[model samples]
Target: MRARALVGAALLAACSSVTPPGLVLDVGRTCEDIALAIADPDVLPGWKIHAAALARSDEDPAWYLASDNPDELALRRVPEDMPGVDLSALGGPHEFTLTRGPIEGQVWLTLDREDEARLWRVDEAGETMLAGPQLTGFPADTSTGWIRRLVFLGQSPHLIALPRTTRVGEVPVHMAAVSPELALGERWTLTAEVSCAPLSELNCPLLWEDLRTLTVLDVAEPGSVAGAALLVSIASLGEQPDPQMPPMFQTHIISLTVQRDPSAERPLLTRRDHVAWSTDGPVLPSPAQIAADPLGIYVLAGLVPAPDSSGANATTADYLFRADVLGAGTSGDSGVIALLGKDLRSHLLQLGSRVAIGQRTGDWWHVAPIEGVTIEEGIVGSLEVGDRVTLLRAGRGQVVVVGDAKPSRRVRIACADPDDGSETGGL
Candidate 1:
């Protein structure tokens, strides 16, 4: 029994001493050496060790090292004169562009005295078309409720509704009798009057009471209902009353919900007295870029949250969250799956497994396992981990990991006694 106990202790000690292999490269190393290892002739093709090194090199250095070290530094210092890649040449609007595909649709805008109307649609070959100059008494800022279905409260008291659609002409809609909001397909329209009086003077004192009601006549529904739903989120702005002095501004999440109505003309959309999401305090600055996938909508906001705070004054941490229409009230779980520590600038390409996070304070990017411990250094360019570690190139990117790869387990034994080696042990 004592002999067995000794063998077990030895095995435990041996296992504990065997640390997992860490990053192969150090900070400040160039991509040339790491790339060479990936293409080495001596290393067996598809070997696990070689693959892991390659994987680590592909991620954005910033995300790879954010958790590894507390003191964040800049990864690469590109010269100001260096020729930067022009992403705008990739064939898309430099600013935000909303379209189902290559086709142009209808856009309606009304501001003060000018009511500009244009019809846009994409052809079968993916071409965009712009037509018309419609006029109305609605203010252009009021159209905020229309574009992207994202509400942006204007500086003035005017309410805007801009809904893009394929159909043209004035459709008989009695919105004043029923509700002041109407939802058609992916677009939602609001028809509300502007009030010069401050909200404090109203008897209700709440913005919801002052909203005008809108009603739609004949309505048609979309063909598919599978992934179609409306989401609504409300946030409050302004100062919280403090007895010590004047009130101070603080932002907070007020409400989030998802609705299943075909038109999305629920009662919640009529609340104009309340503040819009974009106007809420703790405002998130404009995002650098925005994209959508099966998972959710991603907005690459430039501001990065400071650790241990509710994102009041952190400059290094960028914010990424799933964008949803406020009235839709879809599941909260759907937005912003991963909050990366690095800035949006470091995220080169975010695909399945391979992600490139830019590192701080070095020419080389830090590469590490996407699922395991984060590695921050000045030498690595990109990092990935799967069946093996991999290092990505600065110019050439790597494939994203869509799923996990299981590793094969093998057992080996080394016996100290040659004579006793002949004895066999049962599996």
Candidate 2:
């Protein structure tokens, strides 16, 4: 570990040779990007990034601060509201405040002995616990102590599989969304080595310095993802990859063209409140609504296959779940984000689908939908696909299935090894 840490520091120095000296951490990049950026060829990847830290840094890129060592760091805990088991019986004397038990919120862990480790809550409960193998049951590279003592407190043990290497630099790592906010993928980078840079000086921010360690958060970005509230006419391209345009589809691509008039079937803006977008291209729309005459506009909407896919193009439903509306948009290519109305959203999700483009006279462009768009709780709409609708977080023999970020239904989950328990068959 010590040798790797030194090597990691060397790699960081190498980064400075390539990157400008003033900005050690590229604030413009995502946490995942920065994490991979600072990785050494032999460093091991970590499971999670500090969410709170990322959020803060995003708001203030200049405020890149150092944090507690991730190895010595405790994993965040499940929300008190989130379902979890009561392992209060698994108590100990090494625990400074064993009374509260291993409660919820952000946390940390340390080895108490060879057989047991301590779990500490960084929240109000101030709980703690002495855990065993089942707790460290995650599949990390034991050689580097990746998942050795650390355990994220949750209703169920979740396993996060990572890649053996990384596509370092500003490259995009395709990922499957676990929820709207969380996506899962592997970092095919080197074994990780933590860096030893102090924060008091103008040393690179702790967050970026972390990349110097062997940690790569499993997240996604297709170079960049830009969303727009485009009002498009729905249709399907032919059943094969169009010969001239790099074979876009195998079984008829879900296709679209710009629709100008709101009266004759319009495009619905996405996520935000407004609804105008560019008709001349697949460029994402700006915040303010901009209306342009939607005549004679043609942008080639291509469904680039997944990084490893070589089969038929996605099904109509599949295409919608992986929608990519951004493009090298042309001049006069623009749109808005205003609310075209609730009914329009419904029409696009349900009614507006399966129809031919509104005005069929000119060249056509296309796009597809990705999974889990937002909708109000009580008033619902269909996300449709089963896999896209639910995601899993695994640990040991345990798994957690999240329906969606804001699921309306009640959920329950239980985990932990029962053999070590005193009561029953190890509570």
Candidate 3:
């Protein structure tokens, strides 16, 4: 408890995306379970795979060297230095299928662009390029060409994707396990790392504390019992800097796919999906209709409305992430400053013309001044019971010089008036 308090204090002193917390579970028990699980010939097992040799792992075939088909050998090595635009010899059209179960997929490697590891799915319906782990109602995220690692878990296949780091001595950030099941819920968990590197700048350095979604993919039941849960790191700064202007923010999302199973009683991790770029807008149809997409079919994997300041349910009407307008002098900075201030406390602010909040009682909204909001610490404040706030948007309490548009959503705070029913702001 003391250590947690200290960490919380440290977080209060500076902005941080994620801090190490007590093991979401203990390490010793988790390791033993995972060892026994991988003891099951890896998550995606049973396939005698052939392909250009890939980085190998004895545990699962998902990490084994792979190739295009049964007859042809995959290219293990590429030319040291090649001229531009040669797509012919990059690598094989890699294919994979479970010797059992309903798993089947393909990849076309683009050597020139490592991140563009093209992915596809082939099923009874037909074969088509698989674009993403697009979540419901949210935007679909595409990746640059790179696939560092893959693992498959559970009775139904769920994937875990890891990133490549050059340091040989580097330690892993996550662990997972899976149990082969005969039922709809394929139990699995892959301790895969989720980082804010793409969203936070180098100086900010937002690495996840611990984020994973345990997806229950009920194949027999289809959407009936399928759902996802997410725990993403908040955008945090390693060190606070002098604030000259409000920080600009943006959102970055990842496309995930399920690969391998670890053992039993572990977290289920989704795979990172890679797709070629699109000029005609998003590359796939609305996730709603996409077959095999865990997200479109399952309920989104994260908490809604996000916990509030007091760790209560949030009370937000609507919010939008806004980047600071470049070249707009101090006048432009005013709106940015207010929007980033304490929640409903940004009463003395305006964004795109709307910048007023009030005290609420039933359907009534009473207008108030910035000073009218209840000050929490004399530094931080809240929209108190009877208080309502309006602004262009309310960020997660930030004055970012830089930020993202992702995982950022508006939450409505429930109004709980004071017992005395005393009114402060004018109605």
In the range 333-375, model 2's lDDT, one tens digit per residue, is: 2221112221111111110111111100111111111112211
Q: lDDT tens string, model 3, 34-104?
A: 00010121111222223221111111112122333444433222111211122234444342211112232
Model 3 segments more than 4 A misplaced: 1-233, 237-239, 243-256, 261-427
Q: Candidate 1 clash total?
A: 96
Instruction: Identify the candidate with maximal TM-score.
Output: 1
Global Cα lDDT for candidate 3: 0.21
lDDT (Cα, tens digit) per residue for candidate 1, span 1-427 = 0011100101101113333342222232222112211222122112222111111222221100001122221111011121212212222221122212110121111111223322222122222222223223322344322322212111101122323211111111111110112221232333322222455444322333322112111000111111222222222234445666643332211112122345645323311121122221344332233322232333333433224335554334443344333323322322333344442233322222222233222222233212111212221332222323222222122322211243211111111123443222211
Worst 10 residues of 1 by lDDT: 1-10
Worst 10 residues of 3 by lDDT: 1-10
TM-score of 2: 0.18
Candidate 1 residues lying further than 4 Å off, grouped into runs, are 1-117, 122-130, 135-240, 243-247, 250-283, 286-290, 295-312, 319-336, 342-427
Question: Which RMSD values do the candidates have, in order?
Answer: 19.6, 27.1, 24.7
Q: Estimate each model's TM-score.
A: 0.31, 0.18, 0.19
